[model samples]
Target: MAKNQVAPIKGMTLPQLELMAAVLGAHLGRHLLDELELERVVYWSDSQIVIHWLSSEKQQNKFIKNRRKEINDLTGSKHWRYVPTHSNPADLQTRGISAKEFEDNTLWFHGPPWITQPQSWPVWKECDTTVLSAIENTETENCSETAKDKRMEPTSNVMDIVQIERFNSYQKLLRVTAYVIRFVDNLRKREDRNQGKLTAGELQRAANMWIRDIQHNIYSTELECLRSRTQHHLIRQLKLYIDPGNMLRCGGRINNAPIPTDAKFPLLLPGKHKFTHLLIQDTHQRNCHAGTGTVVTLLRQRVWIPAARQIVRSVLRKCVSCKKVSGKPYLAPAPPPLPKDRMLDSEPFSVTGVDFTGELHVKSANGRDKKVYICLFTCANTRAVHLEIVPDLTEESFLRAFRRFISRKSLPKIMMSDNATTFVSAAENIRRLSQSVAVTDTLCQAGTVWKFIPKRAPWYGGYWERLTGITKDCIKKVLGCTYM
Candidate 1:
């Protein structure tokens, strides 16, 4: 017979109560002994749910699975008995009562009196032993897989053809071609610097190694054998064979061609790989900003990269030196609409424009040679031009030219010229014309308005400037490059 034991249970559900009973019973059975120091354990709970869970074999939830395993491994579910809630004594500690009430409750101290009598103890009915199957936990799977064809080898048969037909210089092409060859040779030796040219054997081994590495990553499924049609279709179609050196190469086009051992078999490489990038940079730098065509031609002499032209172009596009050497031209914006003065109609010489043009060789009145600057005036509306000769750009000389222009073309309403010192600082001429009441009243009555274009804007006065060009051309025809 087991001694009476009443352990307090709190902060746990009814199912938990049963689980605790099962765990504690298992612990005592393994570690404790009864008559003749032999261990005997009997587990009891008020929860039918826990008793059913323990008895059942299936558990989907990991928490339940772990607990059930422990129970079954230590103490069998047959040892667990279901008691009515009222007969359970562990609830006294969980639901507290006054000390006087506790003292009055004998069940709280010694458990239900029937627990002492084996025949009087509660028995679990068939319905009590009935188990509920835990709904199988369902989870949605989100994994997605897509298949893509891998490019393990060059697709085109004419991989040897150079896309770019021309190169800027032969020396650049030769240097780049050598560098590419040197690069492959170094990789074959798997070392940096000073590795002499690779022989046919060494080159084949390197090419074989590269092909194996690529196939391992991309065409893993197709790597079963050389005869595997699904893998390396292009390599198979070429009737290529791996030499004793393990270098993949094609049989010669002719049965008997005088080809050197190294040149007899060409090495295979991916057209657009890290190796290609290295080759492109090497060739581009050696060629010194060679065109796409030139670089491609050089590259074709040795290895092939797919879309070689596009690759060369892309690589060169990033070359800082290339961009600097062949940059875009500076384009000025189109000529703006003509200003209000030029657009509107007026007298032919009403809105006259003026500019200095030439140093014509003229004979003086005394038959002495002299140089004179010609002030060219053009009508804004009619496009008629008048030229006046002046000995110098002085205010007096310009004033004389102005008077001559006015005398011949009539006193104009407005005059426009560039903001040159000769035109802007004409205070003496302006003062004489405005204040000289003694000389002639015609100067004051002319009411001529002088307008100057923006400073440093020679192009703004394009009307007269174009005329100057024409005048220069006509004079050049007659003078035939004369100094004058």
Candidate 2:
């Protein structure tokens, strides 16, 4: 005979002990007897109550029901044979026999006395189902225990078959979470009017329940201690409390203040909670991609998440809009080396800047009002101005003004102006004149070097424009409100 000893767990009753023995017998039968090709298997237990539990059709309590199911699953009820407490050798180990007495005990070393004689083996009895149900029901009258059983009851749609993918960005994730929360809030409002707004406390409760559902096995003891009203170190240190919503909240000094519902008791959350990223993202978007301080302020108005400034700063740092809007301006490159002409000492009229002024009204010899534009040329080094009036803005009219200015100031070596169409065309015409040897010699005598400023930058030729402004003021005073 092969014997195994198992000490009863503390606080376990005789029925629990009997169930444990049946499980051990099943293990032995599978490992030893089945390997030896034995056909018959019997489970012997001294506790009749355990036998009744296995045979009972109606399960009265959740604990007994679960254990009874396990016992039947491992061994058939027909295999269970009742044994008197005195005849069962397993009881010797249960009551514990002295080592000196156990050295000659046949019941402990071999099998029970009745096991040697097949005719003397205990018989199986049909338990009274009604009497067993009545007795067990009366013994298991615990309201809290029943409530636990209800909580453990498996729902039909408890498991979701589909897979969910994580959101791309933290902001996107929080936006999605906020949308889901809003939807759930709507559903709750439809069910009951009091559930109008989904508070942070309520959201925290949902988050906790979700966490417990997935991580119950790992955090069972901690969560149980938390729910048991024990003096949890965290609860005392953080001033945390579970509201009627069953959410962990930071119970600060805001209870008496005239604050909003969210700030009164913000949800206390773990550092690694998934909602932390989403909350930061949501707050950022809510404030219209605001700065760290604004985002933190807005978030505090609704949820009292910790590291508010840090988390908001982190999320905002990665925010595309915030980066585009508030990113540091690139340091302007060091000013380029000034042009040689502007820096070198030269003759007063040797370098000149030329530009156009508007069409002014001048009385024609035919007694008809005519439009004429002014061409202003200034000596860049000396800041002297020469203004000439032309009829139209064509190359010929501008050439006339240019020839008159050159005649008055002699010829300039370098002349700079904006890249106006007329100036470009006149420069091209002058270059074409240089192709001829006669015209080239004439231009070489003038030593005119035409330079065009960058397009649309009139500030580059401010000297000539300033002279033009003064000429305009003088003309305006002379004309006195005349359309010129």
Candidate 3:
């Protein structure tokens, strides 16, 4: 049995492809042995490098090492042997041949002539050990150098108290950290075991402990200066001090103000720390997603984070509720270019756009007011217009107004209008009028085509619709509240 496949697009060395082929052959041999109940089997290949790799015991790269191990497990290394390229029958299949030649080829159908003779099998010499040992020593030196580099890496100075990153909410972190501290305290004093919902005092102690540890890790140099009575340039302007509980607090000009102590000297916190993120996030939620100014004002009551407004703004931006309430709407893509009818430079009124504008009241001959409508026609290319007054919105009235337009401006090849009911009825009437046998030859030969824009899209007929607006504005300005 034999199998073939195209090579991968990612280039690989020739030796790697050969070893992969050996792996495929080993699997095939194992399957054949189990199905046929054979006593023994052997694997053969044309590449000498693959034969040596199977027998070598030294370590190699991961790609070669893994495949070598699987090939050995399926077919023992001792059973694998080499065959000369000319004598190997598998080579004939890899190198192409004509169909007529392949049909009469005996080497492919039957093995090499020496295969039936037991004593004539090709002998595979063992690879030299001296060269292999040197290669192995070089690989060992490389691995040692990698380990030495890792050992000399620097360590982080920031001490995480209880894995603050694991908790999402600020309240949850405080509660969990408080429980851990209470558990440790109870271990020392077995006589007094305080067991119930955590009291306010216990939660307060947990918050203070967290703040103290964070300050110690990040502001160690500044704290050391304060203890030694020496001012550091970083905090010399802030007038920093250590309180009785060994916590860093800010000292301001309001030392004698008659107000709360927390407002006087709030706890100092680094703006970029993870704990500060959680604190700002919790304050934002507790205030019902208020504005940044409101959240910053509330946070300043107890903790003083440097660059507080900028940090609070970043945290608020990530809030899901705030995003839902204030996010901008998606922008629409640009409008398409104008259609062919509008772009062509044809004769005036060759392609005409029509629409209706009004309900102007006009006095009839009987001296009573009568309602009337205006029909406006615009040239698609020249933008010239023609107007006519009709008594009503019926198709008969519009057909008369249309006849008047064509008589003065000449017949138009294409007529475009909105999808109003009156326009639709008039288009059908015009089609029927053109098909009548009694009509004149000029009207029948013209074969005028009527087109309507898509329903509810007034912008599609803006060529004439804009004229309707201008005509109405002029009429409104000229005849304030009187009938014409």
- Residue by residue across 1-484, what tens digits does model 3's lDDT show? 7887677799997878888888888888999999998899978898877877788776676888899999989998989878888888877877888999999988888888888886999887764321222222232443344345543212222234478878899889889888987887799896978799998988887788788888888899987776554658755656566665566777675655687888887889999998899999999999888889999989888888889999999989899988888987897678789889887888899899998888998889999989999999999989998999999998889999999999999999899999888899999988887877776576766668999898898878887988999999999999978887
CA lDDT of each prediction against the hidden true structure? 0.63, 0.66, 0.81
Between prediction 1 and prediction 3, which has the larger lDDT? 3
Error of 2 at 63 (Å): 65
* TM per candidate: 0.42, 0.40, 0.51
Cα lDDT tens digits, model 2, 150-208, are 33412222113211135445434433444464565577675643335556655554444
480 in model 2: Cα distance from truth in Å?
9.6
Clashing residue pairs in candidate 2 (N, C-alpha, C atoms within 3 angstroms): 361-484
User: Cα miss at 14, model 1 (Å)?
Assistant: 99
Off by over 4 Å in 1: 1-282, 291-297, 303-318, 324-326, 362-369, 435-446, 481-484
Q: Cα lDDT of model 3 overall? A: 0.81
lDDT of 1 by residue, 204-273 (tens): 4333444445434443443334423233565444434444433344434432346454344444445565
TM-score of 3: 0.51
* Alpha-carbon deviation at 261 in model 2, angstroms: 3.3
What overall lDDT, based on C-alpha atoms, would model 1 receive against the true structure?
A: 0.63
